[model samples]
Target: MSTAMSAAWPYPLLADMVLAVHFGVVLFVIGGLVLVFVGNRLATWPWVNALWFRMAHLVAIGVVAAQSWLGMVCPLTTLEAWLREQAGEASHDQSFVAYWLQRLMFFTAPEWVFAVAYTAFGLLVVLAWWRYPPRVARSRG
Candidate 1:
């Protein structure tokens, strides 16, 4: 790598940004279901019933579950790991935020345990879809 490229890349900061994005995705997958159910009951938050939002939420969880069941690591996780390595930093020992986020998302359990958990969570999201279906957009008269 050229010295200019090495100096301009900012791999460590990029890796940290990826970690933060991964954390936000995790939050959305978990919290989105809660909001869907609550919003359905309240009838005050119609945006939660938006088809686009629901589809995105479903797809996000679906990808996670599919990756887990297929025994494949997430691309985001792989990218972050690669970035950290490029920056000459340990995967889980980088900074305080990264360390805690790793601790929260990763566990020492067997692979099958994670597969089962992800499948079950995916099923719950499916159930939520049936329970509170997304609203179809109305055509203008």
Candidate 2:
């Protein structure tokens, strides 16, 4: 049975923990956009349009795009890799969650491809901001 893990990989637990946090961040960045559209059309999920939430989402993706264009790895990914190497190895096969999240988060792609995709996605987020601008709900007397 082959896996992303190598050697004894003693830090499988910590590595998986980092991987889970990374996956959650990925989901927030992607899902937040999806909800912005869905929430607006349905006139539900008012929190989606909150200024703070929108700004945070925008900043999150902006950083990702800037990092890609500048040829920088995500800090979270760097930390996770460091944790894996600390024990000389970590195994993705330690648990079902780890295995699947690892699969979902990683794929082989050229650097330029990622840079372009991130930039395009960042543009879409900007467009969303324009189309469905965020607002703070004020109290009604």
Candidate 3:
């Protein structure tokens, strides 16, 4: 019976789930750009009320972008690919964004490309930060 259960769950689905979470976080960072431009709609969310959270999110994205730009591989992508390989699954192979990005995260990029991308992402991050300086609570006496 125990062997059956083990066989049923041979792969670590948890790692895949974590990869999904990483993807979601990436989406949020990109989407947050739209939110910044759209309006104060994000403020409506209770979570957004926390300045620290916003700052952290912004920083996290900035770091990811920086890593990408520096030609440094993303740990999450490497881990995901490794997990897939371990599970006897073929890694992604294609072009456009996914193929190349997956490759970039797995294999390092050229210095020039990394520099250019990093610079661009850094600019975007700066713009976003300026637009939405973390909200501060007012203290009433």
Candidate lDDT (C-alpha), each: 0.87, 0.85, 0.61
lDDT of 3 at 38: 55
lDDT, candidate 2, 34-111, per-residue tens:
999999999978889999999999999999999999999998888777776775655543468877887888878999
For each candidate, C-alpha RMSD in Å? 2.9, 4.7, 5.7
- On lDDT, the stronger of 2 and 3 is 2
In terms of TM-score, which candidate is stronger, 1 or 3?
1
Which residue pairs in candidate 3 collide?
69-114
Best by TM-score: 1
For candidate 3, lDDT tens digit of each residue in 84-130?
55555565522244444444344365677656765676678677667
Ranking by lDDT: 1, 2, 3
Which residues of candidate 1, in runs, are more than 4 Å off? 1-9, 139-141
What global local distance difference test value does model 2 have? 0.85
Whose lDDT is greatest here? 1
